[model samples]
Target: MVDSVVLVGCGNMGFAMLKGWLDAGMLQPGQVHVVEPTDALRERAATLGVNAVAGAAQLAAGLQPRVILVAVKPQVMGDVLPAYRRFAEHATFVSVAAGITVNFFEKHLGDKTAIIRTIPNTPAAIGKGMIVTFRNPHVGDSDAAFVDRLLKTSGAVASVDDESLIDAVTAVSGSGPAYVFHFIEGLTEAGVAAGLTRDIAGLLAMQTVYGAGALAAASADTPTTLREQVTSPNGTTAAALKVLMGGDRLKNLLTEAVHAAHQRAIELGKV
Candidate 1:
């Protein structure tokens, strides 16, 4: 029963989700309202035919959106939440600002407000991202389901009842795209070192990662089985894997990286 939505802050991530919803036809432009302080950003949203305003005070009088999604930076959220507190009684408050928890929203928006905290990555701009959410107890099943439908327009959506798992989500999918991008950069450098032209090397590295990820997603076989299928004994792929996986080198490094990110997420939540 989500009839309309109010999206506060239309920066990169916010704009991406906004476009996703409109492009998917899940919600009409008239049904969406955007509040962005930046002129260029607000104009960008206006071009999409949605109502775009500079602040909450400019929002249509008597507005009661089903969900008010706050996408501003975590640092500024304290100043932003108070203006929208009036909507807490009816509208579900959804925050995409990292490290801001459900309890923080309740403290600002009232304890009775339904709040959803989510971590979404940059890939969502292209409609290919992973978004994970954790909802406060006040959120009803229908409201949760409606939010899921809205989030799905951007990418795959998953939820967890245990709010603590959100930090793990931040470490994993929320920050994972950068890891994959870095790996592509390294692979491209290696290709250039092996005597390939820089352009050719970059293209190969990018396509290989893209193709492999697509295959992994489409195939019924497990990734381990797929890797084994491509790697023959004493072959080139095997040799490469030996250097990468010897003594679990790559695995250990990734585990350490994820752990560091997880710890940082926990620390941020405390702030």
Candidate 2:
């Protein structure tokens, strides 16, 4: 078991992860330390009984954390990571910052340090997130398992051997929540246009999407097969799908969007 974990930032995503870990009994508050510069965030973390510090220098002398979770923004990582290098000699470093590569941590922490880069979606706050992870070659199986267990506190976890696939992962799962949200918005608007009240439209749109996603996750059949099961001869679903599936409009659009997101993730890594 990890004796101590140091969290670098306590933003929305970071705080959600911390809460999930604590609530799921994956970590104890007494064993966790958080470094959040903002007073509001620090106070928030402190309320959870975590030792919230304004900076790394505030950590007790000679303290060595078992894991240092880097949750800061990618643009600020270079400035923030060096201070944690002292812990790298003994601890595994896990970064949840989007678009930040393991190479970035390796550069700051040195070649021998174990590093894991993970991308977790927004749904982590609700304990239904999908996280994809890639570990540096320096990380052993044991260390990888430890990191995976920690992540599973928030939601499902998957590991990929190829680091390059991380960008693709970011494109699909990382940005997927936004796509789903936009779909909900579109559906709600269409329902309203179809003469339903705004509140009713929203309820129908939200529940339908939730039900569809739940069915997709629980069903044994493939999504294509499930979709076929829903469509009947010249039915309403078929009529709607005609515009969506015709010329593969939705598929092509989503492909373009994912590609754009993948490119942006690569660009963020370079920065």
Candidate 3:
């Protein structure tokens, strides 16, 4: 169990991670402290039996937490960080804000502070997220492991040695859920165009994506092999595949999309 943790935001992402930790028996409610400015948000965290405060100034005096996880938006991170600098030397700072780099944290905190930068998708709220982390040189192996353990309560965790790859990770898994959601919308529209009611089309589209994803995760075979298994010569599935796979149309479009997202991620980092 973690000795003590300070979650410096009680928004959707922060609240989700905090709930996961308590729900999974990874940490006791009393062991966590949440710092959220909003009254309602702070009260929400307080309902979980943890200490909730409006700001860092209200934190217990002489308190030292093992981890201080920041889930605030990147735009206000500069303003929010200075208040927590007093704890930087002793605590491991884990950030889940996109486009916020380890160097940024180091600049706000200190060069020697242990920091782990992570990008997690919105699905993390439901314990089905893909969390990718990159640690600075100041972080030790045990610190990395502890952060990983805490994050795993929300979903699967993976690490990258090169921080640059995080931009690609953001383009892929971080933004991938939205792409899948758009695809579902398109599928539903297609179903409607094919004479199905809006309600029925939505159910079919949503369930098909869900079921296919579940199957793909559970199957040992590659997606290509699984796709081949479902496709018959000149059959209905093949007809659809022909439209999708013809001249790599779908692949090209997705590549372009991911490239756009990747470049945007790089640009955001520069900001």
Candidate 4:
């Protein structure tokens, strides 16, 4: 049972996960503790009825959390994490800070400590995020399952067997949201160019993307099949495909972008 969870940062993503757990009844306010130095963020956590402190020193005495979630910035982790060493012997450390590796946490906490690393996207703020996690071998199945259940409250959860795949996951799911956002921007611009009002264009673009994503997710058919289904011979979609699919323009561009993101993730890990 995850009786107590300590979240070290209360930023947007961290706060979203906390809200999901509370709203889903996966966690009780009294069982949650937040450590954030920022006054505004601390007050925000307090508004949720959880204990909020400026630092680990203020955590209740003799209270070892079941999970210690590190959500701080990657650069500050080196300075912020050492204070939680007392819990290293007992708690499972979970980090959502991108670019920081399991090795970093293990080194700070203890080699024997169980660490779980996750990369989650911004959509999680709306309970539609996709999160990919990797558990250190020291972590057992039960602990991993508990973490998975907790994460599911926010969105989808997938376990990665190999830690190396986490960088790829970061590139695909973590950075992928920005790509989709840019697509929406482009679509909205195209709609406006086609003589629609700006507001109407924005609405249509957003809804179209949302519907398409939902349909793709709900169907078992491959995206290629779905695209083909939409492209009747000599149809508008076919005309559009002539520009996008011609020479695999969209495919190659996306591949290049994801590869660049993956390389950046690797560099961040080293930092």
* Tens-digit lDDT string for candidate 1 (39-95): 999999999999999999999888899999999999999999999998999998899
- Residue 29 CA displacement from its true place in model 1, Å: 0.6
Write down the TM-score of every candidate: 0.97, 0.94, 0.97, 0.95
Tell me the deviation in Å of residue 199 in model 2.
1.6
- Alpha carbon deviation, residue 226, candidate 3 (Å): 1.4
Clashing pairs in 4: none
For candidate 2, the 10 contiguous residues with the lowest summed lDDT are 97-106
Q: What is the C-alpha RMSD of each candidate to the true structure, in Å?
A: 1.1, 1.5, 1.2, 1.4
Total backbone collisions for each predicted model:
0, 0, 0, 0
* Candidate 1 colliding pairs: none
Top candidate on lDDT is 3
lDDT on C-alpha atoms for all candidate structures = 0.94, 0.90, 0.94, 0.91
Residue-level lDDT of model 4, residues 6-125, one tens digit each, is 999999988999999999999999999999999999999999999999989999888978888888888899999899999988899999988888889988888999999999888988
Better of 2 and 4 by TM-score: 4
lDDT digits (tens) for residues 102-205 of candidate 2: 77788887878989889899998788999999988877887788778889988899989999999999999999999999999999999999999999999999
